[model samples]
Target: MAPQPKHKNIVQILTPVVLFSFFSSSLAEIFFEERFEDGWQSRWVSSDWKRNEGKAGSFKHTAVKWPGDPDDKGDDCFRHFAISAKIPEFSNKNRTLVLQYSIRLEQDIECGGDYIKLLSGFVNQKKFGGDTPYSLMLGPDICGSQTKKLHVILSYQGQNYPIKKDLQCETDKLTHFYTFILRPDATYSVLIDGRERDSGSMYTDWEILPSCKIKAVDAKKPADWDDREYIEDPNEVKPEGYDSIQREILDPKAKELDNWDEEEDGIWRPPKVPNPAYKGPWKRKKIKNPNYKGKWKIPWIDNPEFEDDPDLYVLKPIKYVGIEIWQVKGGSIYDNILLCDDPAYAKQVVDEVFANREPEKEAFEEAEKVRKAKEEEDAQRAREEGEKRRRERDYDRRHRDRDCYRDRYKRHRRGYSDDDYHVS
Candidate 1:
């Protein structure tokens, strides 16, 4: 069968969702999103990454599960290197900031980033690079053990800080929906495949949260405070012969060999073993400490820098949405990026996109497995056929040699000249 085109009919698969987005809820405004359905190349600014890394670079569009080798420059799929698009401006002030996207890590990621960043500063469309500043970076950042986590970094006051809780990301070679929602009440939630995995108040979860309360300026630990809860007994003492007993003794089972000679052969000695009755580092028994107080702590006072703005949940103006990444082996297909202010609507987007994807994924995996199995079977059959042909050739050669030897022997034994066997 002739191979099918790499990119085909992806927009048809997402037509329903794309049509629905036009009729999406009026309250929730979708500032930016990309399904990469058709002609998505016009939307994004593709970097000329071929000059630098002559080996692997570029992102392509394809409907199939496997897009084929990325190094093939002639393949229809090697479209762009990195993902970075110019999006419209939108503000999350007093509204929920929902950032969601679909990503498939289709490559064997040894040590690289499989994450996306949402940049907000004044970005040069053609000059976006790895060092370009971004406001929020979310998704799995995989390297060695030094960094392996679902990195959630939110920039506040020109400083970037990570979320306090450890959010583990999906590392499997499959498509996953990552949704990050920062609500108007300073609370944030992250969902994978439409299931909530991590959620908390951004004020408490991120170090960017300004301290509303602070320690008192003159606070100090009282000098008379006693924090110890246990003390040694006053009358405890060691026994008279405690020090004389050895901590280890010779094992009775380890008998000296009978052939031992002290002068010439050197005598064998029994191996020393731990003494069963030995106790290590004897100390006085602990007693309840009287007049003991709890651990000392300083009182907190109001922080002058903190002004309760009832709108801590409100984020700054979001101008553009982009995927700033530094992937090592780059075959990460990113699509269906929906930015809105409604949780239910965002979830609706997820449901619409991945509604039947679960079943499709299963079928896709099964097909791949079958393809591999068939390939192995074909390879084995070819090997067996080659071996059979080799054996037949060997048999023919042996029979030919036997016939030539018989003819030569018969000619020599009959006393005829060797030339008589030839017709000429």
Candidate 2:
């Protein structure tokens, strides 16, 4: 080993004291006074008072109970303050800064919006007229949980360091103290109530510098992104069965291409051959028949008409099952029933199906309207009942006062009558 490292007596004697002082300052514990004396000296206290406008006034101080009248209408969340002086100024190289304090929120309000934010790295925005102040934040944005808990968060440069602590408090009394420590270096760690609860680290490139200079950032103009130039809507009405089963036959995304008909020549068309037999696009896969096991002599099903056009064949009644259909050469027969089924019955069924659906839709709308109407009616009735009760109470109070006044007048007249008559 090299010569034993020299340790001066002075350094050895003072090391523990220096370390203790450093830790004591970093801890920054708050002690509550026993009596109801000046609460301001007990750092980060609130003096929020309820004003006549049902809002908390700007004046903040310290008090024993909640600072204002309880009927302020706004939330009675914590209006206290927090101060941490242990955090040091950030330089380019220095990485770690930690601050810890005890926070106890009054249980009078809902805990949904309770939060504790440790702020440091101060900057004056009034000098630059900028929106954000230069600081780092590490705290809990606790909402929806009332159980006392602790949180650890780190803010390095501009991005948030994702480290958190959720610890159940040992007690619920307002005087509970929790010690928190934050370190933003190779990692961030938090100690809650003298125990380490969480830690996290951040990537290196996120070191954004705090600057006092302000410059004009670009504001986007509204016209850049809009594409609605000029297009007229035809508002076409589709047939009843259009949305029902027709979607099964058509590829949903396939629509007529907008510019397909436009070209240098008149109505551009694809090349076609005339007088060709129906050699369909189906291959060997279409040759196999469905499993029947000779149960019924359904020989007409083997013909290619059923295979070529299922929409036409599947609906044909058993009477026309074997009828062989001929190819109609280019004469458009649009207004004809292609299938041999009872077309009138099919039409009736389709109409009746849509008609039945209409009542369901109408009933849903009616129910919604009725619910809304009932709610309004209930509110109106409540108001009327309240007014009636107030009027009845006022009448009863006036009647009581009138009877008391009459009795007092009779007593006075009886006392004065005999003496007054003799004197007259």
Top of the candidates by lDDT: 1
Error of 1 at 327 (Å): 2.7
Clashes within 3 Å, all models in order: 3, 2
- Which candidate number would show the highest TM-score if scored against the true structure? 1
lDDT of candidate 1 over 1-424, digit per residue (tens): 5444353211101212234455556777878867654566778765554334342244433344532221111112231234467677667887888888876665555455545667776877565656667778787776655566787888776677888898877766666788999987888999998899989987679876578778886987888888888989989998777777788999989866777788886767788999987787778899988968877778788788876667665555676666655544434556568888787888887777665566657755876798899999999999999999999999999999999999999987899777977885
Off-target runs (Cα >4 Å) in candidate 2 are 1-60, 65-96, 111-122, 125-135, 145-151, 164-171, 183-185, 200-424
By TM-score, how accurate is candidate 1?
Answer: 0.60
What lDDT does candidate 1 reach at residue 13? 13
Worst 10 residues of 1 by lDDT: 8-17
List the global CA lDDT of all models: 0.68, 0.31
Candidate 1: global Cα-lDDT?
0.68
The Cα error of candidate 2 at residue 58, in Å, is: 3.7
